[model samples]
Target: MTLNPLSTPLCVVQATISQHGERAQLVGLSMPSAPFGTLPWQLIGLANYIVGCQTSDTAPSPETFTAHMQARATSAIPSPATLYPYTPWHDGRVRLLLDVTLGPAKVLKWPQASLVIMEQESGSGSCDWVRLSRERTAERILTRTVWEIEAEAQLLAGRLREAPDPSTSSLLEVAQKAARWARESRKAARAALTISQAARARHALRMR
Candidate 1:
């Protein structure tokens, strides 16, 4: 089932979760160069959070995950997973509102899990529900996930330990902690991505 029911440049995807079998699945996603033209990395974080949970055996409680996500953006430790600089409240509103509705639901059938990625295209009065094939979705998620991890790693490496001017020592200390958190998040995200998927992600990295 589509979420928005309107046309859009950014593709929409749907994944169904079952009580058994694979947990969270990357249903489908499309990161178009239009609306996301300025912040494609945000897409990677979105993909990881969603797919990573789907693939995991033990999913985080919606509230816990939501808070875990919020702290990343609001705290001194800003995560690449956050939309801090780009959107107000760092997209927390979307997470708080839509995500809770995504979990297992009997209405979707006995299997009890389903989700849809919906986005509003700029200038388009109506929201869109894009369609992407399974292969396309997996490819996008894997590629984006790898790119985000590497980009963040590079950012942390460059700033994490930079010696601050004497006057800025206090700021540096805060940065250090934030960097550590970002590093940990990256490590966890990498680990959460299954071994085969990680391999594919790396290959995708190499190809680019």
Candidate 2:
């Protein structure tokens, strides 16, 4: 059965300065199966992520979606995590569930292509539990700042490829180069953040 599009899970990963030096929020979308459930989450998220490109007040801030699969990749123990989007239908807050046994897999297969919304057999009482089965939801939140950089790079490259004038072509090529450089810089920043987090973890362990 098809699930409700508006009911899809949305997890807020971070609230920080965006690539444009403006306040923004990064979110993750967990997808369980391919051919997403007709929800425009990624499209919406992409638009939010590129809001800096637009010069409109109504445009949303830089938000991103990190797609994840609910299935366990390795044959080892299964540990999983889940998030519930903020919906008005429920109480003021929603419950996020995490499974210690089964872990989630990052579904990098063509961006939300393998996401499936899980459903429970019983329709009464534990509706949230039902939604957990095979639900296409984001398990872990990654710094989505790279998405904007990568998108800008792609846009610049496309413009360069289709430039009608030599001057415009040169400018687009230069922009594309800069965008690529920025994308690389974002990658390096992410790597550095990972290292920083590891170091903090080690320090915390030693302190204990």
Candidate 3:
């Protein structure tokens, strides 16, 4: 019997931000071996260690970090501060997004798997990751951003709208609405980026 993707156990993916001075690069970690139904605290600790190790050579030793993470895990109730809702993957796996930020670092690495990092850009599809599976070679992952996702959704909505089937009209309407919302969100995000850049420029002038 085939199981519903929604009913599958949760798999957490870390969408980390590696900050270098004033710039931020988005990083995604592909953990094919990530155990299903992993706890939030455990994932958080793992993410911290991964980010720490990648971001700096001076990062705390694995033993030290593990001890600290363990202490936090047992002492407090883990909150969804960095966690996002579940998104079902095409492969029938559900993914939970964990947002994390790492400070300035000169180098980044993941010994076990490849690390794909992309600098944020202005246009859609500029900072997104696309993972592809190949039968002959290792899995390949690329960067993707929210803007690209919205753009793709809008394009898909357009195609659905043009479909010849009459029964799809209702579905098309829903898709169009979602596409509109995504477009608005993209606009707001761009505006926010503009404001942030302006603020940084002003600060730079003040410092000078």
Per-residue lDDT of candidate 2, residues 151-206 (tens digit):
64466567667765676565455445544544554454346456666888999999
**How high is each candidate's TM-score?**
0.29, 0.28, 0.32
Candidate 3: residue 63 Cα off by (Å): 28
Model 2, clash count?
Answer: 26
Model 1, total clashes? 3
Ranking by TM-score: 3, 1, 2
**Model 2 local distance difference test score:** 0.32
Number of the candidate with higher TM-score, 1 or 2:
1
The TM-score measured for candidate 3 stands at 0.32
Model 1 vs. true fold: TM: 0.29
Clash pairs, model 1 backbone: 12-130, 17-113, 24-54
Q: Candidate 1 lDDT, tens digit per residue, 122-175?
A: 343465233222212333344544554455546545554685354345444543
RMSD of each: 13.0, 16.4, 14.9
